[model samples]
Target: MRKGKWGKALGVLGGSWGAPPELCPALTAVFQSLVYHECHFTNGTERVRYVLRYIYNRQQYVMFDSDVGEYVGFTPYGERNAKRWNSNPGWMEYKRTAVDRFCRCWYKTFTPFLTERRVPPSVSISLVPSSSQPGPGRLLCSVLDFYPAPIQVRWFQGQQELSEHVVATEVVPNGDWSYQLLVLLETPPGAGSPTAARWSTPRGPPEMPPDAARSKMLTGIGGFVLGSLFLALGLGFYLRKKVRGGAGGRVPPGPERLPRQPGLSGLLGVTTHANTNVVDGRKAFIILSHGFK
Candidate 1:
């Protein structure tokens, strides 16, 4: 490989114009290799997205061909690249190795020209201090429910784990089966509210104003009452309709009649004292119309 000339050519053609000539050869090799890998990809945008998914955060990278000058380097997969990249039992291990190799290669070969930007892996813990009065309250946290089973929960006051004052309650499973662990901390002296004053000791609770505490309890009760009222109203309406002989709604046509049971008719009065034995046609029609009701 022609080092000096190749480096300059690769730097310019590979889109690494800022890189010095000495570093060109290494950058060129990486660029060319990436290009070869990307050749199998049909969509250029997809290739770029795939590279970005693995990289997490990316810096400027140029591509070089052994014969051609420079072009953009990218992965063959799209933004949803990881989904396309098949994973198996050993896939995760392979990915870790690849990341280490890439980091080492970029650091050694590119040096000052190819700056290695470190993006720290992040884990966010939303600290919700139970009612700033250093007392019994629930600390709720949101987390992904599926895939990785058996999550870990820990409580720390500043640096040390809170042993005496804290207890992890039952891990409640949500409707979706995701788990949430509530940490209950008993109130201690000098415990201040989360929003109020800061505590002198790391473990002590913050004192919340009495009014604030009262208001929180009242709000919870109010919500419960409202919910109960709606439930009761729904249930009462259902029962009322059922009890009123199941006939309280819009009236059915007057002609509608109940079918007589086979044996039940004999138990009822079969009264008949027929005084109008002589039936005129007009009188019979009039009686028939009245009976329809």
Candidate 2:
């Protein structure tokens, strides 16, 4: 069971996800008791939770508790609240008396009925692509399924801690009896630089190197280009060979031969007329059939 401030977004809790029907009246009473306060409540078989926050003009006070009515956590206004509360003896005395009385009463009535249990967490880490950087990328460390809230997570490089380019989400309840948190780390562009995530819980030891990932991507592209070049060369060679073979096998026509006459042959001092044809780098000739004149 748990409760927290939802501000103006309280309307979101009006449907099935809202507080249990049995606890609405008690929560409404707590809200109306103060001029300006927001209240949320959750009740389960094992535990009951309540969170009350008071806001007047600008002053604020946040208080939370589980099972028992005694405040497990409390914060009043800000640094100014400490100074102002201490300045007045009567107000300081009243505040102390009220807290002691509330603790004593709640513990006596409810502590005996509380249960003892522990829930272990589930953690997952992954690398996600980021548009903020052209290469390299971002890492997401997700911690989930833990019981009793509040866990610590940190980023590291070898033994050195990484403080910059990191973003963390607040602890959020998982509807079930667990909580979750998300921590993001931005990897700087570099070759073979390793990044690690360390968590207080016993679940994480995830490491990723930006250089190795980049190298793999480049290797795949290089293989594709080399293969394409070989394929193109093979196709061109086959086409050239086919054309040469066709040219070498073709036959050229023989040149026309003129008829020989007996009188003409004597005048020309020739016994035969010849015509030549060239094919496949060899020459041939046709000789006229005529006797010497």
lDDT of 2 by residue, 1-293 (tens): 13445532353344224565453444442433232222222342223233334443334543323223333223444335545645777864554454335544564465344322335455555657888777545667776676557556777654477898889999999887789989887764233334455555322332223333345556666666666666666667666767887433222222222222222222212122111222223222211111112
Residue 279, candidate 1: Cα error in Å is 99
Clashing pairs in 2: 192-211
Give a tens-digit lDDT track for model 1, residues 182-242.
4444533122212111111121233332334445666666666666666666667767887
List where candidate 2 sits over 4 angstroms from the true fold: 1-116, 188-190, 201-293
Task: Evaluate model 2: give its lDDT.
Answer: 0.47
In Å, residue 38's CA in model 2 sits off its true spot by 19
RMSD of each: 30.1, 34.0
